[model samples]
Target chain A: MKKTKIILGIGALAIASFFMVAADHIDAPAVASGTADITDFYAFQAEDPNNVVFVANVQGLLSPSATASAAFDENVLIEFNIDTTGDNVEDLVLQAIPRDGRMYFFGPTIPGSVGVDSAIETNATQTSVAISAYGEAATATTNAGMKFFAGPRDDPFFMDFAQYGEIIAGNATGFNSPGVDTFKGTNVMSIVVEVPKTMVGGSGTINTWVEAKTKQ
Target chain B: MNNIKTILGAILISAFAFNCSSDDDSNNNEGSMSIEPDFSGTYTQQDQMGRPAVNTVFVSAASKNTFNVTTPDAQGAAFQPMFQANLEGLSPAFANPGDMNALMQTSADFTGLLATDVLNLSLDGETTFFNPATGALLTGRNLTDDVITIELLLIFGGEDFTENSQLSNDNVDANDKPFSASFPYLASAW
Candidate 1:
């Protein structure tokens, strides 16, 4: 196993005062520049009220030119952890990995083991979708009442980072009305899954998080 | 004009050929072990996220790697003090004695919840990231939802949402692109 040591950034700035504010875009230096960098995680009730959707966006701040070449690293796995029992430990996990040009998905099944390390649940129910290219129509796949998609998408996070920076530097006390959207034209490589509520197995509530792991 | 047509024809042929080959590969591997990808081995986590901005705004620069690798169940005990101290130090809304957020949580209580770092989604509710009008809080996050603004409100907007007028909202209210109304709703990339 190869471990990448990250050199922490400048220590002069008061860390607490500088809020990056755009979810995890300006993240810690370790995974900040790589495909493993997770920029945002969003879970929401689907259009069909009985279903829920989970989205994990990585490789943020991709420009139009960069997005065309951006690809989901085959060595990296994106996992969505669902803690149905409320203990904050994942009771179930949905893992997605890319092979060739398609994204393969596995599990809403019980994870064999959990935490910072993960083993792909090969035996779990699996499905896949061809990754959509930059200028093509989006593609999606469905199996066992679950739908999945993996591709580049316009970043949905809206933040006035410039104004926030001003506040941090004491140059401004408040954001101006209708502040500038700093992430206006950026993009992210997004992975989305929509699963039935019954499939998630929570007692009407669940604690979920997303993680990107590199194969060792 | 003939040269342009020849170029277009060549491009179309290559695209069609590429598509057919990939489709054949997928068909061949449909349910067989011959082409089944190897997924065995340990994958070490390098990055993680749950609730937007929780780890970003609270964990210090040096502690980020530690915070990312820490399990959510263990996060509170390990990082609550750091979160609480930062919240109290940075936000004026939490500075005053007995100050409480819109959730009616004190600095310590709020930080405690924030420290856990996992998004608490209600599987059977209005799924929103703090909708003031309907009083929905952290059920889930929607694409069009003004999350940063909402987060600012929770952090600096007092219990009744009338305090710290300047600090309470980011003023950027919506996504640059409108999301689709159906499955895989995120808009196509720019």
Candidate 2:
């Protein structure tokens, strides 16, 4: 048991070092460019005022050439957690997973269990969409008042990392009038789900987060 | 809203019927065959995010993994002090006692909110990330939202949007590509 504990301590130290190199658009060195690396999460009011869209972008900084071969790992499940009670615990979860070139979705329903571990809400309302290819027209599907799409898209989070480094290093005072975008030409695997307001119950407000969980 | 519900109800019924028939159809276009997904095992959390750069900026390197796994409800109490210390060290806007940002939040209050690391989205109002015009703060995030700039402004812009002029904004004002106008609104991959 002491040996096991030491091994775990070493592992934790290694991860801590990895975090020094990680940034918003990237992650720890262990899973830096892996499919489970979540880059960004966005929840916005849809064009239809009654609907809200949640997007989770992963595998950041893919080049145009690299994007063609980039694919969602079948083993990773992207879960969107919604908390309506202002308690920060997830009251409802929407899960998406890839299988056989298509993306399958479950929930916006109450989860069987919550927190770091998850079981796919297989019994919830299910929907599927053909995962779009790199250079093809986007594919989307709607079912049970929710729309789903999954595939590659431009990394929308903009940053001037080089300049940021300069500022952090005390070499620069502030940002330039028109700083260069460090993530201008990169790509990310994105999963988007738009659900009606009626489905996600809250008093017009909710706390939401996204997590990438790999099958254990 | 009622009309939309009526239309959606009709669509839902049709979709249910179509799904029932497609379940038996062998030639469904989605894939080779329709099968219930086997979600029998546990999935361990690997990475998590809510607000765009909160985790990247606030959580210390040694605590990144710990913060990622810690539930949001528990995060503020666990990390707020660390976040406040970091903010006071990094940003001159919070350099002194009782210094506040444009939001009128002291370093402690600001860091307290940032420590939780979850997006607070408004379901009924305009969704945006700190819109200057309408004062819509954290209702949600839009694809085209200049989130980094807003975050920078809050961190360094100081009271009345005039402190630390050099550190106020990133100057990368918009997304590299235009977002789509329809559902699944992200721009095409480059």
Candidate 3:
């Protein structure tokens, strides 16, 4: 398998950015329920206070039985896009892909190109962690102040999609308080990375996004 | 485009799987048959989303492909009209019989805000969805933020923000499991 590098960027600018939560559990037809489907992307301040954690969850809505046999596809690269200048253009990316039962990661490095296209950054810092198997202890690897984990995790996004559907169809007026979660029992393949804020961009506010780019 | 690619990839993967299974049986050897995995060439973007429910709420079923591949910068120009139309359909503000949506600002301004689908990270203050009660608005997402509720308010809630109290929140407020306090903090799978 060829090495796939992902670029992730974190900015520590003194400025503030608008907060938004974007998730799409609806897998479009082309990559519906396949390994490349990105159901949620989360970037938040870590508990350490000095670090930010980036979590990208794919292959959404898997059942307990289905997750036991599910695995990360080697050909698909999950890239975290970081835009430091507020241009919505990625300045750095962290790429993650699996190979030989291990998840290999590359970058937090600048890319040669950007936007809907990516190039492999072979010379960037590389780290590999054993892919945590289902029903086993959680495994994490840390190197140079960066921590990585790849495995199945509970789907964290809570949406009363059925109720929202009703509102959309004009059948209902509003959502019920303390609504039911349609994704209560499901799971998703998760890739988690925690890194120091200084390592990404240090002192500028950055816009971050995640992408599941399949190798051509 | 991604559907076609996935179908082709599936055929190739199944064929390769068959080859590997047959080779293992014939050789009676583990790792004897060389099954080189091909991860070469360029992988195209099949589906993309920056914010929750933007594609789901704004884009129609037929326009998903175009919406997915279009970059965030180009999105406002391409899909803002469609989003405006969809907004009119879903928002009760627009559906008030003879009265127009109270929040019906110019299509350009409203749609431009929704078009570029990137998550903003506040490097400084609280990272949250919308905290109108606290007066902090749209900073970035925390794991527990009621994002759908915020999106609904923005779409349906008018200028004074008191328009639709009933239709705004979905009520699913928290995650199924507690988030961890350490690295790789997502909860474990069931």
Candidate 4:
């Protein structure tokens, strides 16, 4: 028991260190440069207005030509954390994982457990959709009022990162009129989930975030 | 929206014909997958984020591991000072010569505000990164929020929000492609 506990602790720490190395776009340590890296997280009111959508984009900085064969890693799970009480603790979690050309989704329901660790919530309300292949028509699946999609999409984040770097380095004062889009023509593998507001604890204020976890 | 959905529906219908074997039995009956995912052990967090550029801008490379592992609840206490120092260092407009931005929050308070690093959303109101119409801040993010620009302005713009105009906007105004008008609204991959 003691040995097992120590091994688990070391494994958790190792995963934590690996997690720190991935944030937005290129510049991540080489080990995390692939699918494990998350580029952005966006949560907004869906067009239905009664539903909310959460998008967690990963593996950013892929050129158009390279995006053709890019795919989601089967081992990683992307989880969206929702905190309804403002305590910064997640009350509910919605997770997505890809397998055999489909992205499986589980839960906008209260997590049976929470924290740095997570279980697949295989028992929670679940859904799945075909993983939209690059250059193919997109595919989305709707189940039990929740919608799911996982696939590659044009990288939506636009930035003049080069100029911003210059400004931070004290070489430039401001950006030019039409700032160069450093991410132009790049793509990211995006996982999007839209759920009814009521399903996510409904009608007040909430704090949200995203994390990528690998299956142990 | 209708056109994309129609296209998607057709593709799904055709794809399902060829790949129906992949569907897990869980759809008709929950927890009944013949092959269950390996969820037995704890999967530790590798990375977390609530807002754009928070970790990349505030955390020095040396502190990336420490910063990434800490939870939002503990982030403020653990890294607020580091954020403040970095903010002041990167933006001279926020340091000795220029006053802090319009919020007038002290360095500690400012960093404290950002340290938690989770996006705040109000369910009852319009979801947006910031509502310029009402002057509200950080409610939720939109596809075209120009978040980096907003972050720069808040950190270096000072009391008038005009202290460092040059450093305020990044010049990239919108995504290269227009977002979809329906479910799963991200633009198509190039």
Give the alpha carbon lDDT tens digit for every residue of A39-98 in model 1. 999999998988999999998888899999999999999999999888999999999999
- The digit string of per-residue lDDT tens for model 1 on B88-139 reads 8888889888999878999999999899999888987799887768988888
Which of the CAPRI classes, incorrect, acceptable, medium or high, describes model 3? Answer: acceptable
Chain B TM-score against the true chain B, candidate 4? 0.78
- Regions of model 3 farther than 4 Å from truth: A1-22, B1-40, B94-108
DockQ of each: 0.61, 0.50, 0.40, 0.43
Tell me the spans in candidate 2 whose CA falls farther than 4 Å from its real position.
A1-23, B1-36
Ranked candidates (TM-score, high to low): 1, 2, 4, 3
Who wins the TM-score comparison?
A: 1
Clashing pairs in 1: none
Clashing pairs in 2: A174-B166
Give the top-scoring candidate (lDDT).
Answer: 1
Error of 2 at A167 (Å): 1.5
lDDT of 2 by residue, B71-176 (tens): 8999999999999999999998999998999999999999988899899899878899888899889999899888888888899989888888788888888889
Residue B64, model 4: Cα distance from true site in angstroms: 1.4
Candidate 4 deviates by what RMSD?
Answer: 11.3
Per residue, candidate 3 scores C-alpha lDDT tens digits across A1-216 of 122222221231111111111267654556656788788878777888777888888888788999999899887888888888877888888988888788888889997778786655656888889988888878999988999999999988988776776666678878888788877888889999988888777755677778778777
**DockQ-superior candidate, 1 or 4:** 1
lDDT of 4 by residue, A135-176 (tens): 988899999998888999999898888676666566876888
True contacts kept of 1: 0.90
Q: Is the docking of candidate 2 incorrect, acceptable, medium or high quality?
A: medium
